[model samples]
Target: MADYRLHTIFYILTSLLSLAVLHWTVHKVLLSISRSKFKKANNCQPIPKYPNKDPIFGYDYWHALNKAAESRTLLSWLREQYRLYGNTYYARLQTANVISTCDPENLKAMHSTKFKDFAIDSRRKFAFLPLLGAHSVLLANGAAWEHKRAMLKPSFSRSQYTNLPLFERHVGHLIEAVRVENTKKGQVDLAEFFLCLTVDITSELMYGTSIELLTNGNKDLVRDMTQSAEGGHARWLLVFLANIIGNSTFSKSVSKVRNFMKRFVDEAISYRQHSESRSISAKPTARNFEGQQGTEPLDVKGRVIYLQQLSLGTRDRKAILDELTTILFAGRDTTAALLTNLFFVLAHRSDIYDKLRAEISVLDGERPTFEQLKGFNYLQSCLNEALRLYPVIPINTRMAVVDTTLPVGGGPKGQSPIFVSAGTNIAFHVTALHRRKDLWGEDAEDFLPERWEKIQGQGAWMYQPFGGGPRNCPGQHLSLAEAAYTVLRIVQEFSMITGRDSEPWTELIALTCTNANGAKVTLTEA
Candidate 1:
């Protein structure tokens, strides 16, 4: 009797599931038919799609998934598609169709010209809410996003020169840590070390208090940040479970991070309030920019701390937390990825490395001041080239909020404007775009920094590693400055940077692009 009952229950469950699936299939077929008829009636051509050999699941998702899994990255597969399908192409991801483009005009139209017709993919933004917070500037829409951008603008303005000293202090810590590693373990995992460096720097800047992650072993938060960003099938499953039950391992972990962030912000706010209440004497002089050896008084005329800046911007604690986390997440991973790629390239090419060292040598063993760092055009070029090759955020996606037409790349001929449906998801392939020979030269795939010298500021739309338009990253100046300074300081302190991996490092897309394996390198003392 018990066995018969169990079998009956299983049969009923399976029948219901099968019916649900059939219903979904019928709905999808009807929707497709309607869309096809609509396009035909309007004389509109559809975007070209990669040949789907196995259409059982509605697309060749398994083939793309298998190939991407084998490569350990979706970027390699996307690049291959670009090679075969020209600048614009489409592929189905699960139930949704994703159109990808590397054409600069199309990219410009989507990002800037017709920005009103599209918005950040709501699904992607929702998935990130627990990590980035509900009020995050990166996730906000319309007026809220514009307001956040405007508020944060003054804080990151060019006049914020005092940040150079803060950068120097952190780089000093990074160099010290590297030196310790040089002695203790012949090679250091620079990937992890740079992450620690950025974490310490970002933490200190965000809250006016340093966690000193480089010196200490408390890297749980950093590890969690990376894990959250590198979430896979297991994480998604946990997320689904959490959503259903209101609690799961993923939710707990997210809560841990959120609580940690809230605590830090609360403490910082408390400290600022206490400091404001007390009568404080003015400090002596501006701290030396070289070593950051002295303490300068806060609330100085021309000086601003990020926390104070946020306080000025908004009184909402959640908003402050959102912006801080967003900035920290952005500032840390992207810069570290750039540094990792830069050193990885420098390790192999002695000629380029030599030229870079020569350029930095012009500073004559002295720490380059903010003004001095700017004049190293070659250093900037090298950074630019590295960004071109390995953009930290290789792929970005947007959803068409309203029906729109792309500038070009559509129809059988592939030169006409493509009609995008209201709900279509579009991806701007930065990696492929950067490598296009027509936009760049024939040596677009090559790592020649000299190319930047010729085309500097010429093709803004084409060369958008940091992205472009209203929603572009505002932290570029700070990121570039820190990277340049770190490179200069590393070269000054070390004679050579050689690593175990002789060939190009495989990319791992985490919070940003990172080495699939950690970047292991030995530093020879200068």
Candidate 2:
């Protein structure tokens, strides 16, 4: 009787399993048919697809991951896809159906004009939450984004321009560090030095404290941050999987970095509290911050440190930490990349360096004042050319919240606009867009600051190294000013900057474009 019951149970289980398999197969077939009919009814041409090695098992994604791993970048693969598929192409990754484009009209629509139709894709935000914080301005959308922007925008005002002296101090430290290297070995890994300089400057200016990373640098922390950024680029599905699997090494490292950042913020907050208490006790009438110039309005100088502004509004430490990390995220590498690239190109070209040095010579060996930095048109042009050639964030992404049509780059002929369904993600390669022969001329690849000489009348949309529209980077002016000041300082100290290697700058992606082998330069003392 027991044997007979066991046989019957086995048969029942097999029958149910077969039925489940049949149901799934039929559903897939019906869904495929429905999609085809829907496309036909719309009378729209499908977006071009880049052929992949495997279509069924997400082998294309795997292939991309492997290639990215081998090349230490995903940019080469993206450029290849663009070459094969023209202006726009469609590919299915593990996370979403990606529509990649280099069409300027399409870019304008996605980023500026129809920005409301798309978002940063909340699904992808999860990957960065552990690192950038949940309410980070970099990831927040809608009212949340606006609030974060409001909190930090005032801190960048003209009165805060008094921080130029602070920027100069760090630049001075950077020059000293490099000068020592020039005396001893005649070469410095400027990539590393630039990272340290930016870290110190960002900490001091924003938190009213300095980490001294440039003076006493942290190699391990820098390596970990770079690794975190690279991991930040991983597909969302993989991140989800890692989260579900639980206790991942990546998760641990992320936590470690978060803790490290939190500690930095806590210390800054502690210092601010102590400083304020001392100021109140010492001077009952007024508690003055040293950098606050008497002529500068309180609206600007009073809120120079972002943390102080936030503390006035809320006692939420997590929010403060989030904003602090956000500032560090924005301020550190982006400026460093700009400065490093500027020096990299300047090191290779003597004429440009000579002109820049002459520009600085007029300052009479003193630090260029805030207004003085703005007048260096050649310096401004060099910075612009470097940004155009190697945009720190080369690619930007958005996802449609509803079915939408791009203004251009579609159809079998590749000239018509494409209809992207809801949830479809779109990306624009700023690197490719900046280098468009049609937009920037045939010599777009050349690093010529003079190209910008007659182009003062151009629109802001044409060159968006700092991004665009309402969601555009708020720190653009500050970055330009800081970089221009640093270049002037460097020029004042070094007459000639020479590349350690004659071979061209080997570009690499580390959440930003940087020298792959490192930007090594020898300083010729002024």
Candidate 3:
């Protein structure tokens, strides 16, 4: 009886093992057939494969990438890769397939033409989830993303951003801080001031009150935010290991930022509830200003409040908080980085500074109205050039949600469509794209604002400093206006600004990129 039972058990185990093997084999065969058909139907051609020393895992390529990042030469190294390989090339990273491209046609296809075929991917969403929350528009996808985008769109309308008076008070605080710093240190770190200025302005817009970092010198919130952003960046860089290794500092910093933001969130919610109870309408009123029509809801003090406008969309506290945090993060970093990078270059190039000053001279010591700022062609060119050279978000990525084909990045000359498998990661290098000689001419690597004057437009996919397509940054207009206003104010105050540090601009790349050496400059009071 015992021998019979043993035989039966052995037979059952063997049968189960055989079935498992058969299932795996069938699945693989089907997948192979499907991919072949897809590739054939699309006329897909093979793309250049990166020469990886460790072909299986591409450890050699990964090591080189991390090394470049550590040495702050990641941007230059990536640009060099495009020169060696074609505009698009493939590599393997462990179990994942990676495609790196600086091709405009590929970018346009991924970002716009076939947008629904791609997603933000789990890895990137996971990296940002801790700080931005799961509901944040930056991390959301599909229906969730559309809903969040809708909720936030009203808050960023033209009227809300064009309220120049909203930023003036914060700008005053920044000017005072710069004046004091210049008096004491004989040179100013404009990068630091720009960060403070943006933070203050963003806070004011979000809560209808400023953090006053420029005046109060309270940096705890800023410090926590920076640490959290750096932690997110690190996690994104080391995505494979992010889930395994716990980062206690990252946790603590995210907690601090959330707690700080929650206070404002709670206040906004309470205010909204109270206003509703009193039957006060939150709808924006149209107002005509300088022959232009715009609309914005004003607080009791007659100040535009983003939080209030956001509250009207949804009473959900968590939703409001997530959107606010994401906006604050974007609003604070992008403009500051743009201003810092532009100033860093201007400090080095006196001729560019003089030309910019000449353009702004039309304002004649008068605070620039929104219309007036828009009219300054040379000033806009400088901003455009700075963004091209040092885009705030230098690199971006998207993941294939379905098997698709990029319009280019295949064949010998890379003019053929390439099949992309679902789950493949595509990293588009904006810094490299901006410096493509074929697109921007021989002086592509040089900082020349005059180039903009000669060209009609940057040709859709060729220049995307603020990105493109549906997910393109909504805050870009606001950022440009703030940057232009701030630059005008600084130039008006100082007759001459010269670089204090002789070193060239090195990247301090985090969630955004800026000058590592800081915008260190000496100013002559006008």
Candidate 4:
């Protein structure tokens, strides 16, 4: 009886193993047939492959990328790769196949033409989940993303950002900080000051109260937030190991930052409830550019507080917190990086500075209104030029949710359609695209604001400092206005600006890119 039972068990185990092998074989055959059909139907051609020493895993290419990132030359390295391997090429990163492109046509197709065909990769979303909640607009896709976008749109309306008085108060703090730094050190790192200024402004706009980093209030918050962001970036780089090995320091810092934000969320909600119970409206006051105290009015309504606007949308505290944190992160870093990069160039080029000052001089020392700031032709040109040279988010990636074909980046000349398999990652290099000689002329490498004057427009997909399509930055006008207003004010106060650092601009990339050496400059007081 024991021998019979052993024989039966052995027979069953063998049958199960055979079935598993047959299932795998059938799936592989079906996948191969489907991919063949897809390639033929789309007329897809093979993309240029990188000349990797380890062709199987592309370890050579991966190692080179790490070295470039460590030396702060990743952008230049990427540009060189594009030059050598056409506008787009394919490489294997470990087990995954990666496509890198600096082609505008491919970018347009991914970001706009076939937007729904792609989604932010799961690795990116996983890395950011700690800093921004799972439901963050930055991480969500499909219907969830649409819902978050709709909820946040009203808060970034024209009336909300055009509150010049609110911005002036923050800019005043920045000017004072710069003056103090100049007196103490004989030179100011405007890059640092710009970060502080944006933090203060963003906090005030999002939470209805400033953390006041400019005045040295809540320095720990800034430090913690920085640590958290760095930790998130590290996790994004090592996504495979991130789940297995946890960093306690990263967790603590993220918690601190979230807790700090939650306090504001709770307060906003509580205040809304109290006001409703008492049948009263809450009004916030701000000092005008002239330093006069007054209640700043917007469309005959009181000041538009982002927190208040969000409270009306939904009472779910976590949902509101996620949206607020996501916007705050984007708004603060983007504007700061823009100011740092633009000012770094301005400090070196006195001619450009004088031209900008001459344009701003039309205000005759008066503060600029929203309409006036938008109308400054030369100022707009300088901003455009800076963005072209140093895009804040230098490189971005999207994953193919379903099998799709890119408009270009295949065949010998890279003008043929390429079949992108589902689960493939496509990284689009914005810095390389902006600096392409073919798109922007031979002097694309140079920082000449005059280029904007000569060109009718940058042409579609050619100049996307704020990105393009449905997922394009909503705070585009806000950041531009803030940078423009701050620049005009600084130029008005200082008679001349001179670069203190002899070193050329090197990238200090985090969530955004800024000058590695900092924007060190001496400002001669007017």
Candidate 5:
């Protein structure tokens, strides 16, 4: 009886102790967050307060204009902030958190040159952590990033993987997928079609498997990524917590995702291992990465040319899988969204469609070879126009790595030269920059493909649909080439007609920009 009584008392004491520890942890976390907010606010110059800002769009710094996409369309209430406070304005987003920054020069300084100090929102452990996993090349920070960049360089090189055969095959796959889906449809969702095409092409070339996502029409990876992004526990609330908690969650998720990638990589690695086991001791490398080796790196069509200094054969299984995941998420949705917008735009103007078709017909009465694809100047311009009008990744974020100054439109010292403190949050708001009236010209709001011809006069950094600077998308050519090819094939097969009178809006939840109603279009056989 005495022993039982003692044990019960001990149990009660242990429970109380645990509770105390938790309470202290939470209290300390709240204190740190509060302190950070206060420090940031004190350091910042005050701006007029706007009530009920949309949190979904960079922590409520902006207001939704009725049907404006939370992230993608129109002047974000950010313009209003810029208007009020000259460019560098401070807003108390959370109880103690202040988010600020909007200047082109500041954007350049934070993103490039000094990017090492400002880290990616490592808080993504909960929401976007599983996205690429630890093995994802794009997600890596240190040596891992360097390694992956080296390994994957050959795959997208101009002399190697960017050849006629691969391009045509993938393009064929895209066109064929569209034809199957749009057979005599009263109205086809071109967005869905393009999504499937990108996934199919990306999976086959990158993973050596079809994933059959098109035929089956559902994949866990795509669905999971979108779901986590839209609503995830870890990313949802980090303001009132310690940086350690957020960092741990993010790192843990990356680790978990890397674990997930292991399965796919293991399969590929095992295959490679077995294949090598059967091969002759000495060989001149496999043709799998054909036409890329020992060839002089040539600048093709004025794009940046660099030596293929990294051989991708040395990657571990986890690394390959992560890169594949990143590419799948990045490549598939982006290309799909681009094409969706293009078809949506092309459907209305038969004049534009007529011009595009006339150009396609001149592709020597055959599918465009990669060289011919490059030569289709009008098509490229039209696609570039689409990208400019609606970038796939509407916004990009970074941290202030150092105390810097941003030269915004107009503020103190003639321009809004923002004094950035290290650790301050930066919302690049590419959507705003792309639509900035001052930069894009008088008819910037209009969807005119001829904007490219005149864009030569505009600044290069100003027109960053595919982004600019050193960290710009390595796969820009791949994306443009794929999109151009799909668009070319789409125009070759059918014409899209406006199928609805209902107004269209872009849906921006998390990172991706997708059409709200599936990019509906009436398809007619060519």
Candidate 6:
């Protein structure tokens, strides 16, 4: 209803604006008729000419009233810009509401040094806070964000990750599930399987319990919640409408899911606290095999897992769930999207796929074994290129807290900083930047994993799928490593068929990148 109201209001406004345009246009045309003999051929470029304006809409996403659409996609437009303007040009679709940049220095400053110069938009915060609840690090910033990050950092630390038996078991079950699906249907939904694998892994690692997502694949609860997140984000108009409606039944349902997760987290925290305070000082704990290279969970059965008593320190139940959700969501969705795309790319280009398979074969004994993934330069490069071509998050937005100036160059001499006023929403069109013609050359749109082979020492700003600086995704390195390992294993276990020549379309759901239909493919045993 609220969405309908907003649409009605927008339609009315657009109608009025159109009428006004018609009125002015009639007068202008009359004036032009009178001045045709006097006016020069190219005196003015166009009326309402916005100097230094950005492409408001090329990848037209009318699907979203106020937000960008997923289908038209931002990356495609970025390439179009290079075709016309060398590297930069002003594009206007709507009024002056959004400012976009593929400028490297602009990105570095915004994503890194001057990050706090902007804030997450209040509208977005209101929507997510209800969905994620409070104290979640994802919604937290400043000191709060720091504390939460520090607390969760240890879990992914080198020592804690020594639980390789756990890793092996999770991967084994994942492969097993795929095997079963393959037997049944001659194909498998890789995205769903990846989510299950990540969810199950997060359950064991974080809570020391099996959500049993992998074993039974019956737990549709998490799946449902994820769909909510995805579906909710798909329509910005609805989200805005919900916010406008405030306490409607739909709003309450959103709150109900948030509360449900809250309850689960609360119970876990309480149980953990009770266990810790018990101090059973039980039988002598097993030896500490943590420092050993490539140590799996089987090596430390009775080890004193001091932190087993998961007491919430200073932080509350809500924070834990937030971190838990953030990691789980981040781990599962991004990896699946990247891997799915990798398969599509490889299926088209056999040479690249074969080269990567050989690379993975050599890593038969070296897949993220403690630290091998970080050192797997070829695999790392391939993953980087994939991310560059198609970032999991095509675009990330920031709201300027104050009036700011963005540097512009290679234009008319004496052109200075482009001024953006406070409250102006700035979108870092990452997908556009990724395949930018000036920075990446002509083959920017093409998938060339070799593009990242020598990017480390060069102007790294051109390659920013994970973004750059402090707010740069902390999970990036981990995500990349996990992706390389998983894709390597998938290729090793199964050869993929990209459904003949029928291309899969991508749609942005919420902020996540998902297959418009499904990443459908036929797989045969490797």
Q: Which candidate is the best by TM-score?
A: 3
- Say which candidate scores most in lDDT: 3
lDDT (C-alpha, whole model) for all candidates: 0.74, 0.73, 0.84, 0.83, 0.58, 0.58
Better of 3 and 4 by lDDT: 3
Give one digit per residue, the lDDT tens place, for model 2 in 1-526: 9999999999999999999999999998997787667656655576788675565555576567557746655665666667788878877665467788877778778778988888887555866777778767888887677666766766677655556878878888888888897889968878788888877877776776777877776776677676666566553336466566654555666677677777766664675576557642121211122212111112233545666655443446777777788787688888889988887887788899999988778888987777788888889899989898888888778889876678666677777667788898787788777887778898988998988887874336667787777888877877888888888888888888888877666566645676676678888888
Candidate 3: tens digits of C-alpha lDDT, residues 1-526: 9999999999999999999999999999999999999999998999999888788877888888888988899999998888998899998865568999998888888888899998897767878888998768888888767756655566567875787887787788888889998989899989888888998888876677788899888778778888898899888777868768888889999999888888878877887787778866455433211122323447675555677766665667887788779888888878999999999999999998888788888878889889998898888889999999998888888999998999988889898999999899999899999999999999998999988877776657988888778988888788888888888888888889989999888987878888889799999898
What is candidate 5's CA lDDT for residue 68? 44
Q: Any residue pairs clashing in model 3, and if so which?
A: none
Mark the regions of model 2 whose C-alpha exceeds 4 Å error after superposition.
1-45, 52-58, 122-124, 234-253, 267-301, 457-459
Better of 1 and 4 by TM-score: 4
Residue range 310-404, candidate 5, lDDT tens digits: 11243355445656567666767787788877777776677788888888887644776778887887898898888777777765655555554
* Candidate 5: regions farther than 4 A off: 1-75, 95-102, 123-126, 159-161, 215-263, 275-320, 413-416
The TM-score of predicted model 2 comes to 0.82
Count of backbone clashes for each model? 0, 0, 0, 0, 5, 3
Error of 2 at 57 (Å): 5.1
lDDT of 1 by residue, 290-365 (tens): 2222223345545445666555444478877877778777778888899988888887777887887888887789
Which stretches of model 1 miss by more than 4 angstroms?
A: 1-44, 53-59, 232-253, 271-298, 312-316
The Cα error of candidate 4 at residue 129, in Å, is: 2.0
Checking candidate 4 for backbone clashes, the offending pairs are none
After the best TM-score superposition of candidate 4, give how far the Cα of residue 495 lies from its true spot, in angstroms. 1.0
Question: Global CA lDDT of candidate 3, please?
Answer: 0.84
Q: Tell me model 1's lDDT, rounded to 2 decimals.
A: 0.74
TM-score per prediction, in order, is: 0.82, 0.82, 0.94, 0.92, 0.72, 0.73
TM-score (C-alpha, index-matched) for candidate 4:
0.92
